[model samples]
Every structure is written in C-alpha cells, then in structure tokens.
Target: MKLSDAAVKKAKPEAKPYKLADGDGMYIEVMPSGSKYWRLKYRYAGKEKRLALGVYPEVSLKDARERRDAARKLIANGTDPGEAKQAQKREGKIAAANTFEAVAREWVENRSNDWTAGHKALTLRTLEQDAFPSIGRRPIAEISSSEVLATVRAIEKRGALEIAGRVLQRCSAVFRYAIATDRCKNNPAFKMSEALKSPTRSHYNTIEKGGFPKLLRDIDGYQGSPMTTYILQLMALTFTRTGELVNAEWKEIDLDRAEWLIPAERMKMRRPHLVPLSVQAVAVFREAAKLSGDRVHVFPNRNDPSQPASNAIILRALGRMGYTGKMTGHGFRSAASTMLNENKSKWGIHRDTIELQLAHVEKNASRAAYNFAEYLDERRTMMQQWADHLDKLKAGAEVVKLRA
Candidate 1:
C-alpha cells in the first residue's frame, strides 16, 4: 500500500523494520530507529538489483515515487538505473579531482620538462612570477577574461610589450585546458585582444650588400678572446647562425670530409643541413677541438664549459670593436649571401645553392629538389673560390666585388 506523506512524516518507530509499497518495484523501507530509505527492487539479466535513493522523510514519498518512475522509464528504454548512478558518481569523482589549477599545472609540467635548460628556466620563471601568484590556486574554469586582462596589464604597465604578448598567449593555453575537461565554456583570451595596447617593432641593425666590404674589414678587427675571434671568423666564412655554430657538437663536424652536418632538431627549419666547408673553416674547427673538459659543445662558455656563452658575451665583444649596429652575431649570413650573389661569376656559387644553404624557404619545387652534393665536382671548386673572396677581404686587400 502507498504510504501517505502526512503519515510518513508523523509516524514513530515501531521497534521493528517494515516496508511501504508504492507498486511497480517502488517501495520505502522503514527501520526500527524510524529511519526510512527509498529503494526500487528489480530483476535484470536473470538477477535482482536494489537501486537506492535518499532516506525518507528527507526523500518524501511523492519525490521517491517520482524518482522511481524516472528509473522505470530508463529501465524500459534498455538502461540499468543502478549502473547509471554509479557512472555518474565516478564522473563526479574525476571532476572533483581535476580542478582548473590541477590541469594547468599538468600542462606546464610536461612542456617545461622537454625544454632545454635555458628555456626550462625561462618558462618556469614566467609562470611562477606572473601566473601562479594570481591564478595558480584558483580553479582554471573560474578564471574570467578580466582576470586574464589583469595579468596582461601588469606586464604592459612595466613596459614589457613583447613579454605581455607572450603572457597573454600562455593564459589562453590555460583556458584551452579548462574547456577540454568541461570546466569553462570557451576561451576568454580570444576577444580580450582589445585590452592589450598596440605592438611596437624593435628593428635590429641589418647589414646590406652595399655595406659588405666596409663591415667585413671591421669584423676582422673585433678585439676579443681567441675563441670569440675564431667564432666571428667562422661565422663569416660558413655564414652559420652564431647560436647554431656555438652550440655545435664535435661529432657533427667531419674535418676530413670538409663538411659540417647540422642535425634537423638543432636547425630552425627542423631539417639537417650539410654545410660544405672550405679549408679555412676546417682549420678553425680543428683548432677548436683541442679545448674541452666534458661538455660536448664546440664553443662553450670559457668560464663554464657545461653551458654556452650568453648573448651578452657576443654583444659586448661587438661593442668593444666599434662595429656596434654595423653588424651582429646574426649578420654573418647576410654578409655571405650578399657577397656570393654580388660575385656569382667570379665565385661561381649559384643563387639557388646559396639560398638553399641559407635555409630560406625555396617554394620553387624543382629548384628545391636539386642536390648540390650530386654535383660535388662543380660545388667543391665553387666553395673554395667563395672562401678566397672572404680571405681577400679579411687581409684588408681591395675588395673588387664591392658593388655600388
């Protein structure tokens, strides 16, 4: 028999257990202590299962019966109500465990782990100094666009426009993580661009073909350590980026083969580059091979061989030489490209070959596929002639290749 709501609320304990039936597998079990519970007793797959709702008077007869009817609907539609409740509970546990901050920390940890020593330090420092203080403890989903704008404005106020741009991007990453786990609705950082100020470009001192001869003479005069002098010399001859050249491992260079094999991972293009070496470049690497304690880097910092030199070291060297914006550590490539293209006839180095070695994006499909090594007979002679041009400039001789 169905129990009345008034009777269920006013009834006292009978010092024994009893059941009040609501029909169709729905019933309320009353205990001796006057505690009551809503339950549905049913059979599925030739087995009986009892699905429990909340205890009654707390879960009133009407509400319990309504819940029972909903369960019945689910069962009629080929679903197990008990199994569904358990699945919902499990999902609750996962949602509780994976808070916004928890997921963001996980994302930061994995990315920071794979980074190089320098990059690892930089990323962690940025997050700790700027991100963690504000949103580290706050659940990621709880973070609003205004909160993100606050972090970015803090950077902008300090006159760090580039750094502010980077921080905004990182905050967007946190929002992406929040949305993936059903925490937030969508990314707040997208439309928040209006909060940021306009960007200003800091132009580097780029050397051009017209200024090549004058600059080459100045680079030959950079008064610094034997290591810095040799590094500058190699930078000009090979036209390799200063960072790639400095961080180069001895194993990548084949002095006998007169070639430097830059691996794919180290390169900006993420592809291996075979730099055809001249005799002068090979001599420099051979000289560099003598100094080493344990670090595998060819041109490691003088004080700490375990790491590479700071950008300040090269920049300082440039300052002391009176060649301050005239050329930079990165300008050597421009110097080579300019001189090679200027005297292609005398040097015999093709524009395509020079651009390919420079690692510029060669969109011409046919030209991109041409292998300079396949034409070694022609290339070997050309590489030597190219080295001779630099040697003439380095000797303070009149550089006739200087085009007005």
Candidate 2:
C-alpha cells in the first residue's frame, strides 16, 4: 500500500518491530521505541538488499516515495542504490575538506618558509579580516568569479580600494594553488583583474632642497630624548624606510667596520641590505648604544624596552620640529634619492648603486645577483660623501644642487 502522511504519523509501535509496506520495495520500519524509519528493499546482483531512506515525519511519506522512485531508476541502470548513496557521502566529505579556507591555509603553509614572518602574519591577518568570513567555508570548486568579485566589492565599499585589490590578489594566489593541486578547476579571482576601483597615487610630502638645511638644523637641535635625536640623525644618514630604522638591532651593526647589515627578513625587498655607516652615522650609533645599553633593538621604545620605538615617535618629532606637511618620516628617502641622483656628477656616484642602496628590486635575475656584489667599494665611498654633503648643508656651506 502507498503510505499517506496521516497513516505514517498514526502508525504506532508494538512490542515487536513491524513493517508498513508502501509498495515498490519501499516500507516504513516501526520499532518498539516508536521510531519509524523509511527503508527500500530491492534486489542487486540477484541478492536482496535494503537502503535506509530516512526517519519518518522528518522525511515525510511524499519525500520517501520520491527517493524510492529515484533509487529504483538507479537500480534499473544496473547501479546499486546503497553504493550510490555512499559515493555521495564520500564526495560530500571530500568537498568539505576542499573548502576555500582549507586550500588557502594549505597554500600559505607551503609558502610560509619563503616569506618573512611579518609578511606571513599580515597575509593571514588580511584573509581572516576580509576573505574568510564571507567565502571561507565555500567549496573551492563551487565558488564562482562573481562570488569572488562580490567579496572584493564589499571591501571596496568600505573605501579601502588598495586593500580590496590586495585581497583579490591573495584570493587569486590561493585559487591558483588550488588549481595546481587539483582542488579547483578554475581561479575565480582571475576574472577580476580590472573589476576593482583604481587607487589614487599620492606622493609623500618632502622638503625642498632650499629647506633641507633648516630641516637638518632643526633635527640637530631637537630638544627631544637622546634616542629621538639620534633617530632623526640616523634616518637622515641612512635614508632607509622608517620601520627598518625603528626596528634596527645592535647585532645588525658593526661599528668597527662602519657597516649596518640589515637582515633579509627585515628588508622590504627580502634581501640583506648593507648600509655603509658614515663616520658621523657611526658616532650617532655610539651615542645610541650608551642609551640602549643591554637592549636588542638599537632604538628600543622608552615605554616598553622590549620593542622598537613606535613609528609615531619619528613622526611626532618631525611635527614638533615644525615640519608637519613640509616633510615626513618617509620623505627622507625621497629627498635622499632626489638630492643624491642630482649630485651624481659632483659625488661621482653611480645611479645603480643609489637604486640598489634604496633596496629597489632588479627585474633581471642574473643582473640582480651581479649588482648585489657589485660597487660595494663605490657605495662605501658614496655613503661617506653623502654624509659629508649633509654636514656641509647643516654648517651653512655652499652645497650647490647640480643641474639635471
């Protein structure tokens, strides 16, 4: 008999298990505990077999019949209904294991060895903050380009266009990894090359050549902490990125050799950078050493001696010296690049040495390796001359800016 909703609901259990036949090998097995479950009885390979459809009321009489018919169709095609069900269960488990977050995390773990600690932490943080919450659980193979675009657009809506672009890039990298590993057939993020809003380009505020002397003088006469004064002085001499300068360790410097060897992990280019410390720069470090005494970082924070000075320390000092918009912490690098490139003839400095010192990437692999070893002798001379020129400017000497 074909089962009806009321009949299934009213079918009560007895002392022994009973079966309510619903025809076509589909029946409801009523247990002594009053649990009713739908089951299908069919023959496979000339043997009798049973398949559990679902629990009653939840599965419903109508749905159970539909499932039974579907199973019968599978049986007609010489396929075992029980085997097909198990296959789907296996596929579901595999899909769960191949979620976007799962594959992305795997990819990150595989590449973590090549990335700096900060880069790895920031990459994971970005995904956790942006990508993971939205599409992290979705199967990598099932995710579409439109879904990826939507996630990126949500970030764009918050006015973080650059971050949105970066999130898309990270997703693209993960998707590519998935493709290579056979977890995904396509990279959804690949189609989003031009989908995001372009970020605006803004130059860092820098002091003009005419005002460079006063800026140096103000730094020299800074009434801040001893560490702050030396920080400003060292920043001018090395012209490295502010973070690199702040996070510098005493072990990285060799005052006797007049060199500060910043490790590859701390450098923006992920390559060890050699800064030929000038006589004046070395003097500043000597003062810093006395103040830092027994600290790891050359410029440890005054509040917390364990960490480097906060980035705000440098910016705040510049503001106190009355060069708010006139100059910035990063402006030192720009100013150095501009002034050094212009005075190349006067100093006999090569452009390649300046660019390499700036830690800019060389696109050609062979040339990059050659350049890393090249011109160390020239760079040592150039850094000393650069420092001397700054001293001349501070002393109010005639330091002529050469014509381009």
lDDT of 1 by residue, 1-404 (tens): 66688767776667688777778888777788878888899877778999997887678788888888998888888889999899999987776556545676666666653344455557657777777777666656667788888888888999988788877777778677767757778787876777798777533455665566566666666666767766777877787766678788878888888888887666654556778788877777777776642457777887887777665666677777765876677777766676678887765667766776776655887766545354454555556667777767566575444221
Worst 10 residues of 1 by lDDT: 395-404
Which candidate achieves the best TM-score against the true structure?
Answer: 2
What would the TM-scores of all predictions be? Answer: 0.55, 0.75
lDDT of 2 by residue, 73-187 (tens): 9999999999999999999899878999988889888887656677788999999999999999999999999899999999999999889999999999999999999998988
Candidate 2 TM-score versus the reference? 0.75
Which has the greatest lDDT? 2
* CA RMSD of all predictions: 9.8, 5.3
lDDT of 2 at 197: 92
Off by over 4 Å in 1: 1-102, 112-115, 181-183, 203-213, 237-242, 263-280, 287-297, 304-311, 323-404
**Candidate 2: deviation at residue 75, Å?**
2.5
